[model samples]
Target: MKKLTYLFIALFSLSLLTTSCREEKTASEKVEEAIEDTGDAIEDAADDVEDEVEDITDDNK
Candidate 1:
């Protein structure tokens, strides 16, 4: 019974150590999300600029 208990404990500890590495969402994910947000913002700014240009052209005509 004691040998089986020791074996179980060792296996459990090994399992815990194996599962501890490779955690979720470090800096790369945040940077990627920030980049995606920046792209969307730039696209929105471009659309606004295009609308303004069209408005100015219509006014001129």
Candidate 2:
């Protein structure tokens, strides 16, 4: 009976540890996401600037 109890406890702990180990994004994944976000923001700002320039040129003409 004692051995069965110990075996059950060990299996429960193992299952818990394995579940906790799953797919939390690593540091590199986080850094890549940040870089992609920064690139997107830069692209958006550039597009806004281009639109503004076009509007100004249109108004001047």
Candidate 3:
């Protein structure tokens, strides 16, 4: 029973330590991520436009 209590305490402490050690993004990191996301969105939009144009052209042909 004592060993089981110690084991539970150790696991709880380890969980606390892991949860508290999370990495936070800096302002510049956030800006960079936003820029990348915007770029990806733009690229996806462009691809979708291109696909629509091709479909329209194919239907016309």
Candidate 4:
């Protein structure tokens, strides 16, 4: 029974240690995220410009 108690405590401690650790992003991951953000911004800007052009053409017609 004592050994069983110690085994339970050890497993609980191991689980706590593993769960508390965080994984950090690598440099390539950071670069990829930045590139994705920039692409999304550019795409949004293009959509806005396209909408403005459509509005202008509709008003002229």
TM-score of each: 0.59, 0.63, 0.71, 0.65
lDDT of 4 by residue, 1-61 (tens): 9999999999999998888657899999999999999999999999999999999999999
Q: lDDT by residue for model 1 over 14-56, one digit each (tens)?
A: 9998885666788999899999999999999999999999999
At residue 12, candidate 4 shows an lDDT of 97
lDDT of each: 0.95, 0.96, 0.97, 0.97
What TM-score does prediction 3 earn?
A: 0.71
lDDT of 3 at 51: 100
Model 2 residue 11 distance off true place after TM-score fit, in angstroms: 20
Q: Report the C-alpha lDDT of model 2 over 1-61, residue by residue, as the tens digit.
A: 9999999999999998888556789999999999999999999999999999999999999
Candidate 3 clashing pairs, residues 3+ apart or interchain: none
Runs of candidate 4 exceeding 4 Å displacement: 1-20
Question: Using TM-score as the measure, what is the rank order of every candidate, best first?
Answer: 3, 4, 2, 1
Greater-lDDT candidate between 1 and 3: 3
lDDT of 2 at 49: 100
Which candidate leads in TM-score?
3
Model 3, residue 34: distance off in Å is 0.3
Model 1 misplaced stretches (Cα beyond 4 Å): 1-24
